[model samples]
Target: MTAEKANNLLEQIARSKKEGRLPPVHDWHPPFCGDIDMVIKADGSWHYMGSPIGRERMVRLFSTVLRRDDDDYFLVTPVEKVGITVEDVPFVVTAVQVRDVEGAQVLEFTTSVGDTVVASAENPMRVELDPQTQEPRPYILIRDRLEARIHRNVFYELVEMAKPTLIDGVEWFGVESAGEFFRIAPVS
Candidate 1:
């Protein structure tokens, strides 16, 4: 895509965000305008045309227009939709905060794109262990089928706060947030 058109897309997304709290990309049904040389790396870095998108603000702006349909990721506006490559998940959880809400310990996660989400029944957390290495791939839901992979440091913090809970007659290590219990790992 041309730089001018890209700027136009950014302007459109910015205007939509100003009008409401988020871009209306979900409500848009724009036709696919083919692929763009953009990539969201697993490390939560954005690249375009094989160059890193250094500006944090610009990356956040593009994230607002990002949408997922089924398994594919796209950048959408009222008039256009274009595909982009995602290495793993779109966002990465960079920080996590703990607070008590009505006597329940709440976990609030901050993503690379500046989205803050509280882990609850609506936005649960999960962990997937790698088969070969047994590495933990933890994630928390952000919004609209989008999730952020919990960063290593943040995951460690979560583990430090984990407690055992009974599930299916077995003890599992998990955390509590927003009155919801989320299993991090099954005790072996």
Candidate 2:
């Protein structure tokens, strides 16, 4: 990313943070400023100008303005929008907490960017098997089309908490959170 573009993005982010809430990215419709060299790697590390962004606070600040439109991701402000690359999902679920809510299981996930979300109808979990590797790639909806890739250790903990059930004609092993049962994998 050019120095000018990077400064522009940071200024917008700062202004949005001062408002004490996320910018209305969904409502912003700025013309695309073309793709920037910024990328969020598969492990949820942000890179700019081919160098790792070492500051946690800056990464968190940028994440607040992230928006996904269809298949593309952008850092959106009310007046400008710049596209960025995401290797996998833009966030990673670094930790998980399971609690009893009204006698039902409720799983809360903390993302690498420090955002917390609960697994419920509004923020559902899904697993898709890789076509080539056949490995399960699990994700949970974080916000407005953005998802957090469930870390491997957290996924394993979820597997340990799973129960077997029959959905339609297929038997599956899954876990329940907030009274919703999400299929994690087919019975093996």
**Which candidate should be chosen as best, given lDDT against the real structure?**
1
lDDT digits (tens) for residues 64-133 of candidate 1: 8889899999999898999999999999999999998888899999998999999999999999997999
Best by the TM-score measure: 1
Q: Can you tell me which runs of candidate 2 are displaced by over 4 Å?
A: none
- Per-model TM values vs. the true structure: 0.97, 0.95
**TM-score, prediction 1:** 0.97
Candidate 1's displacement at residue 132, Å, is 3.3
Q: Distance from true position, residue 171, model 1, in Å? A: 0.7
Clashes of 2: 0
